[model samples]
Target: MILVPGLWLWRDPWLQWAAGCAGAIRAAGSQPVWFGYSRRVAWTAFLRPTGGTAAELVRRFLALYDRVRARHGPPSVIAHSFGTYLVTRALSDFEGARLRALILFGSIVSETFDWGTIVARGQVTPARMRNEVGAHAAIVRLAAALRRFGYPYGESGVTGFQLDELSRSVNVRYTGPWLADSALARYCRGVWVPLLRPTHPPRRSVLTLRSRELSRT
Candidate 1:
């Protein structure tokens, strides 16, 4: 199994959350690999998240995945938060490549994210944490769409976007709001940030894109 951590965290997670996960997999008689990365930008944890960071994470994951696969055939993957995006992006290159499983924890991926398009050559077990949050306002949804997926700005009345997507086993669906519907959500418009920032760049513009996803109960 391969373990990955979230944003603002170093790729080398042996001393962090990866430690527990790696140990569990080891006790299960399966070997675990710790991926390494330096989430450094602007020399602060609050750096703006950019696509470059995600891309780099994906690159590092692929490197280790390739090495592990060469030896162990295919390795299951476990990732949390932004690391989830990294794994998703990497496996996408080998769409439909069968592995043991792909587990995600506290994933902040967008609603429209195509989980079915994940890397799996066979029926892969998917799991995630699910907490329910109310639907978002039209403007909140609109701003998130613009920021997360880079949707073009236009007249869109989409009030809520919800998906209880079945994920690869070993994880949970993250239920967090993309934008808090309050005095801030009203004017927190035109938000944008590169993947290089802290979470995912939607929030750093005015809020944290690594937001509590608006989930369907």
Candidate 2:
């Protein structure tokens, strides 16, 4: 699994949280790769009049993905905040980029991102895509508000993905402060570990069961 962290992480405790998540993934019997920028990315970078920095980051992420895929095959990804936007753009705008699964938290990707297209193209498994939404994520809400001023941000981490009912992307909502350590630990152990470990049924069987459950609702 590849772990991508958000901007200004060097100044915040989330980097430690990310490290804990990596430890959890390692404990779950999977390799965890941490993809970080060479320098600190400040929150002000997002307000740039042009998308130069964002585009460069996407390019770098795709390079990392290619290298990892060539060495260890496709990898599952866990991204937060701007990392989510970077991953989403890499998968959506580029071809031949593959992932086994994706888990996003504090996502800033547009709510209307075309996830179904990526699933249809076999870039990411449909049943394995998850968006962890935080009900009290004020930062994501602020990002959504900034979208009106031409910022490329969204409230998907707050409102979740606005995809169709049949879409395989799962939006798991949690209620709490965004940076609560206890909540993060719980999610890493209880939610993300299961997603990465594959202790459940095969993808097709899981999809079939999900379809049946949806039919009943």
> Which has the greatest lDDT?
2
CA lDDT of each candidate? 0.44, 0.75
Every model: Cα RMSD to truth: 17.3, 9.9
lDDT of 1 by residue, 112-160 (tens): 5544544133434343222122322333244345454553221111211
> For each predicted model, how many residue pairs clash, with residues at least 3 apart or on different chains?
37, 0
Candidate 2: which pairs clash?
none
Model 1 misses residue 37 by how many Å?
A: 0.7
- Relative to the true structure, candidate 2 reaches a TM of 0.81
Q: What would the per-residue lDDT of candidate 2 be over residues 7-126, giving only the tens digit for each residue?
A: 664455345467677767877767788787744443544666246776777788898888888876787898887778888888877979988778888888888888779878899775
TM-score for candidate 1, please give it. Answer: 0.53
